[model samples]
Target: MTKPISGFSKLTKEEKIDWVTANFTQNAAQSKKILQTYWNQNDSVQQLHDEFIENTITNLYVPQGIAPNFLINETLYAIPMAIEESSVIAAASKAAKFWLKRGGFKAKILGTEKVGQVHFIFKGDAKKLESFFTYLKPVLLAESASLTKSMEKRGGGITDIVLKNKTDELANYFQLHATFETKDAMGANFINSCLEQFATTLKKEATRYDAFSRQEKDVEIVMSILSNYVPNCTVRAEVSCPVEDLKLSAELTPQQTAEKIIQAIKIAQIEPYRAVTHNKGIMNGIDAVVLATGNDFRAVEAGVHAYACRNGRYSSLTHAQIENGIFKFWIELPLALGTVGGLTNLHPLVKLNLEMLQRPSAQELMQIVAVAGLAQNFAAVSSLVTTGIQKGHMKMHLLNILNQLGANENEKATLTEYFKTNPVTHHGVEIQLSSIRK
Candidate 1:
């Protein structure tokens, strides 16, 4: 059994790895070798990566790839995606190419507003609290001037502040709801700074409010933070072409192909089981782009999943329809992205990605992200409706299995050509590998 040690973080990287492998791993030597192999050769670069987060041992790599030929609003772009999933980049690239032959994707910014809140408990009369808030609104805004001034000069700042009484849900619960326009940045820091100031101002002014008694004036601040559920910070991306343009088959006509695709989307909308996986496929694309751009994928995922269930049932994020001889597929969701802050300016690859994208503003990034998700869904569904999903997916996954079983380059090459016509399965590959060894 492994025993915990003190000052584990204080140990040097080699020492920590040595201790871990010795105590925990079955193949201690091999484990240490694998970990050390991934470390950056340059000491300076290795130190930079280690300092990115706490208790870093070595870098974990995900492949960075490009999906080209994405045309949104008459502007063409090649989207950068960072992901370990085998078929994701290929699927996105195929979808972009398919759409390019038809009229390309079109996207529009729906809104740019982000949200934050200050939660507090007020054990006071509701009417008294309301009266005090009226007096407190300007004080909250005025006190946040220093925090919001830089944001304001960039044409982005605090847009609105309102009081929300949630006493019925939980006793003495109240929130100061705030909204902001972050322009070219994700604005988590900006919104959080403003919220902290709101919390401080509310507490300071509550003591002097003429409307509150001593007990009422003592507002217990629970927390002040930015909300990831940015409903107003949204964009819509869609692709539309004549049904006749979807010539996907010789057996079934273009109209039939469109009908089948729409039916697949409809099932996802009404069925929760299918909807969950369906939405995940969409996020496979969204999250990849979000990571590549060095934005917060966790926040984006939380906000998006919340939005999915907003209609009471979690449904599909991408919608498809056949109308007036036209086939259209589209997606609309909130994405809090930044172009000039956070890892966007720090990570070298992120800066290169922004340059590759022509340095779009926040709104433009939203459109690009939404398009990636839509393209991903289109490719997935197109495969599901026609050739079935596993054909391409299993082929892509073959390389991973081969590497896992320790196939050399020559063996991998032979099997790659063999699997072109042969179906790939774990058991089947194992059998083939054994036969080759024999």
Candidate 2:
């Protein structure tokens, strides 16, 4: 059994790897070799990756792909996606191309307000706390002025600060709810710094307030942090065309396809079991772009899912309908993204991906990411309603299956052609490969 080791982080990279592999891995030599195999060749790059987190071992790489012909708001783009999934990029590309001639995607920023809070326990009269807050708000803002200076200069800063009395929910619980406009940066660090300052100011000012009693002056701060649930920081992306032009597959008529798509979304809206998987397909596109552009996909995931459940029930993020003679599909969801901070300036591929995206601002990135999600959802629903998702998905997955089976060049080429007409399945592919090998 492995024993806990203190000061493991203080060890050299090689020593750390040796210690972990020897204790934890059954084949330490093979494990060590596998870990070393992924290390960057350049010392400088390796050093940079090492400093990104504690106890770094080796880099886990995801494939970066491009989905071209994305026409958003009359502008053309080839969005970059970083993902390990098989058919995500292909599906996104297919959707983008399908919409390209039909007046591509149109996206607009709905809002850009981010939120943070300072939670605290105030055992005081409600009226007294309210009066004390009125006096303390300006001081909280003033003390955080230096921190907001640069952000303000960029046309972004603290928008508002309000005190909420939540004693009804939990005894003496209250929050200093604040909102901000962060411009081109994600502003996590900036928001956090200001929140921490507010907490300090609240504790100090309460003690000095003339309206506060001795017991009320002892405002116990629980925590100060930024929220990932940014409902107001949202964007909407959509594509519409005449219902007659909604030809997605040969088997279904344009009208049939459009109606089926609407029915599918309606099912997702009422059914949580389907809604979770439905929204996950949408995130497949959103997360890939967010990851490619060095934005926080995990944060985006949490916020989007929370927004899905905003109506007291989980529902689909994307919606579709047929109005008059037109077919329309769209998605509106919260996506807090930044193009100017965090790993954007650090990771080489992130920088390249941003440049490939024409260096979009935070709002622009939100619209782009939203469109990616809508496009992905459309592709998935279109597949589900027509030729079936497995047909195209499994076809795209053919190469991955073949590679995993260790099919060489000639074998891969032969099986690739064979599966073109036949269904692709793990067992089916294995049988075919074995038969060919014999």
- Writing each residue's lDDT as its tens digit, candidate 1 over 181-257 gives 98998999999999999999999999988778999989999999999999888999999999998876577788888
- Winning model by lDDT: 2
Per-candidate RMSD, Å = 1.5, 0.8
Candidate 2 TM-score, true structure as reference? 0.99
Tens-digit per-residue lDDT, 1-438, candidate 2: 678999998999999999989998999999999999999999898898999899999999889999999999999999999999989999999999999999999999999999999999998798988888888999998999999999999999999999998888999999999999999999999999999999999999988988788999999999999999999999999999999987778898998999999999999999999999999999999999999999999999999999999999999999999888899899999989999989999988799999999989989999999999999999999999998999998998999998898999999999999998999999999999999999
| Candidate 1: clashing residue pairs, number | 0
Model 2 pairs whose backbones collide: none
Clashing pairs for model 1 are: none
Worst 10 residues of 1 by lDDT: 245-254
Name the Cα RMSD for model 2.
Answer: 0.8
Stretches of candidate 1 above 4 Å error?
none
lDDT of candidate model 1 versus the reference: 0.92
Which TM-score value belongs to model 1?
0.97
Model 2 residue 68 distance off true place after TM-score fit, in angstroms: 0.5
